[model samples]
Target chain A: MAQRTVLFVLFDQVQSLDVTGPVEVFAGAERHTPGTYRIGTASLDGAPVRTSSGLTVVPDRSLADVPDPDTLVVPGGQGTRSPDPRLTDWLRAHGPHVRRLVSVCTGAALLAGAGLLDGRRATTHWAYCDRLAREYPAVDVDPDPIYVRDGHVATSAGVTSGIDLALALVEEDLGRDTALTIARHLVVFLRRPGNQAQFSAQLAAQTARREPLRELQRWITEHPGADLGVETLAARAGLSPRHFARAFRAETGTTPGRYVDRIRLEHARRLLEDTGDGVEQVSRASGYGTPEGMRRAFVKALGTSPAEYRRRFRPAPAH
Target chain B: MAQRTVLFVLFDQVQSLDVTGPVEVFAGAERHTPGTYRIGTASLDGAPVRTSSGLTVVPDRSLADVPDPDTLVVPGGQGTRSPDPRLTDWLRAHGPHVRRLVSVCTGAALLAGAGLLDGRRATTHWAYCDRLAREYPAVDVDPDPIYVRDGHVATSAGVTSGIDLALALVEEDLGRDTALTIARHLVVFLRRPGNQAQFSAQLAAQTARREPLRELQRWITEHPGADLGVETLAARAGLSPRHFARAFRAETGTTPGRYVDRIRLEHARRLLEDTGDGVEQVSRASGYGTPEGMRRAFVKALGTSPAEYRRRFRPAPAH
Candidate 1:
């Protein structure tokens, strides 16, 4: 197999994780399997770039000096909201050389700005998915995916999700065994796809702001355990129960009750994944009346109960 | 409460994930309670240290420049086998200022060599656990722990276990709610403690290496589905069935039949975590006579059945 080279682009205020996570996974792979892949970082300009953490990185190449890349990776950060026009244009110029054009976190915005993501199914950090869709009307924004790959372009959600996408790329370029080895070395399960739900407080907030049931939805997110009747919800939204239900489905793509349940479930999942809270505490905090209630909701929506989900999704603790 | 500062000591060939994974969880606590903690990185010398991935990281300070740190974090690498004398001296000198010293993976080796882990319970990367015990007889090595916090010093099993230790530290310093918030931000559950077994391949390999049992163990790992009766196993090892059973226990610290079952179950677990292969296939591949047999084994050992184990352990799929 030809040795694949990755040209990782770095810049000022870059999110350290967005670049490093994938770099670690791939680097670890190379460490274990010597001479299989070669990766290097480049800056648009030759100077050192300071990341958000204030750590400076000196890239091996300036964009002007970079080798033609087999894979081009663009990592996102707080700076993505107002990216350099020169950098955007550079991305546009360089997009076609790579077999895969991948973006991590809000880096999708840069790609979108460069027109690389136009007409492509893509994702960014969940917090900015809507903005990406709104700003680039041609881009098919999928907020739910951990990462997405369409044709030669790929995009991932948030900082750490890039690791997932990179692992997949490694698996595709090499094989499953290589990917699994890397994942084990990194101590992560292989990455989940973009179709997985991007459930969060922010996503719930977005769902609550749409038409016909905005008031009811807002009330539900705030008071998840409330037993508001359909009639009461409709009256709060100033529509007949029957009409409100139809419009709610049209606008939010889910029933009012089911939508409420989803918000609650999201909260519950967050608690489970993030806390040592027992099933009962998480259930109550998430507006489930009891542990049993939370379990049923989790089983219904995520195809796994809360305890099982926690076991699977819990982040590794740091010392 | 006095704000605690964690200084992660970086060196050439340092494991990137070992440092980054824990730092992420520790830093994330800021989301819940801003200004409560400070995180920084340091090196023995001020120059950038090349991580095991060949990527260079610029530390916040050199040992000479670092303040009196509340916590000192040392992560392991291939370099641990032959550490610089300067780095070891620095660790020895500053070991007194550090209220809590943490070591991840083979970082335990450095601590042990410094005499910091002497007479304390500690662990290193599973592959090196025996070596750690052999070299440092004064240290009580808990090979099964993801991490162990004994007195003021803490050590964790390789790589990802650092995350677990970091979360525990957060919980200790900031309280459960704050730690939970950080875990949520990082999308992980609170720490599961040292009691939870490290789920990796090294343990299986370690278990499969005893005399008289080694050949059968290799066979089991190589052919997970074949049913080998006690008589067959004894014959294969050139011993009478009764004598083989007694010798296997003496040699391996486990009964022969149980050892075989463990190998099969461990293989099933790897399959469950690494593949989308269903329970039946995993069972067949892992040398369980049937899916039901595999399920029973999973239930007995892991407290979860095969399908449920997969749901809880499988890495999320990459898109």
Candidate 2:
């Protein structure tokens, strides 16, 4: 079979992994199945592009000289703070010809800025998801999944998620077996199913900023199996449930129910990581009434199950 | 609190991720806990070093001018093929003063070449494991876990596994909660609690190269649930059990029992990844007589359980 050319666009301050992670995936796939992909790196002026981490990348061709690619990869970094018109203009002009379009980390912002994702459901780095949605209101920003694909365009969240996106692309191009081989070679998870929320549990926990609410939040985290309903929490804080819920949302930017869910999930994760407890034990210990309830919460909050969570995070003994 | 200095040594043709993955982990840790780590990059000549992927990295300082680091990191790449004496000499001379000595991927080769890994039980990228063991017989190359730490000297396998090593380092320096938070932010597995053998199942399957033996190997993979004892396999191959076992080992570099174990493990992994079957069902289907038997196999081989494996690698529903 003829190789599909995967052209990676480089720019000043681009995240090194945003480019290299996907590149390595494709390169690894090629090693597993020869003639699978032809990888290339390109820049605007054929000059060395300095990455955010002080690394410089030499492109295979300038945007003007490079041929139309089967796949186009745009990586994100601090460089996304200032979108280059030349690059965005080029993407707008050439994006349609490309069979697959991808953005890693905050690169989705560039695609949004280029008007390619005006009505597309896309994502970016978790830290920048809110800004991307705010700046490009036309783009349907869903800041959850490691990567999202609407039609031929795909956008991944954060730095490492780029590898997940690339692995998915490899699975799509080759078969599951081939993709698994490449993933094994890379020594990454065969596939990190679900969205990117697992990475944001900490961010969610720190939302409550008020003094009483902050104290309550700490208590809830420390005692996950406790009755953490709005009424109980409000009573603990010496306020009415209705007033406490409203104030909590106003201060934390999230509802009381959502806050509890996040805290419960965080506690559940800690239990799963530190212990070898069964799902039922973990669910009850982490505040859920039943294993089924906790399973639902895991799926809804982290897009995985309690049993699965323990499997992925449980610490192994030192060899 | 004073931050510890983490010095990453860069060289020409270094694997980009081998440097970036760990660097990002420390950087993320810094964001989570300010004054945690001060990151620095250094090179032998102080000139910009070109990475294997055609990227160039600028070092913060030359080795000659840089002060002794609290933690020293060495990343492997094609550069390891030709050891630079200056870098190895520096490692030998100053390695003891560094609080922690670390290597990522084939960087173990560099460390071993410097005689620092002498008699230390270490590991490297799986593909290079045998060669690393052969080249430096003095070093105890295990070639399994994502990372290994003998005293303050740490080493990791492959490129992305560097992140796992760095996370472990962070967990050691900070606490589990902080490391878990950093992992969540990075959207990586809080800790991928298994060895590299999980990733090398396919590699294990392809060891036999001769015709009839290779054909028999394929048959074993196809019938993983079958009785794969040496007696049955020898009968199938029209040879005495004793002769068959010896020939199989000589031809494939592994005993029949070990080969059968690998094939069964691979089959189990595939079933875990592709289906939602219960552990008992998967065990039976994958040739194990009981769930406990399979569980022991999983724990022994991958340092994880069958249920956990299924949770991690199960296919996501199509978007």
**Per-prediction TM-score, please?**
0.84, 0.84
Per-prediction DockQ comes to 0.32, 0.43
Which residues of candidate 1, in runs, are more than 4 Å off?
A: A191-199, A206-229, A235-239, A242-259, A266-304, A310-319, B188-199, B203-232, B235-242, B246-255, B266-296, B299-305, B308-319
Error of 1 at A255 (Å): 6.9
Per-residue lDDT of model 2, residues A1-117, tens digit only? 679999999899887778888888888788788888988888899888877655555677799999989999999988988878999899999987899999999999888888999
Computed on alpha carbons, the lDDT of every model, listed in order, comes to 0.76, 0.84
In model 2 chain A, the worst 10-residue window by lDDT is A198-207
DockQ of 2: 0.43
Best by DockQ: 2
Candidate 1 lDDT, B1-319, residue by residue in tens:
7778888888888887788777777667754677767888888878888887776778877888988789899999887889998889889989867899999989999998888887888887767888899899998997777778888998888686787688888878887667655554543345432233424555443453566577677776687677667898888899999998887777777776777777777788788777788877777788886898877766666555776556435654444
Docking class of 2: acceptable
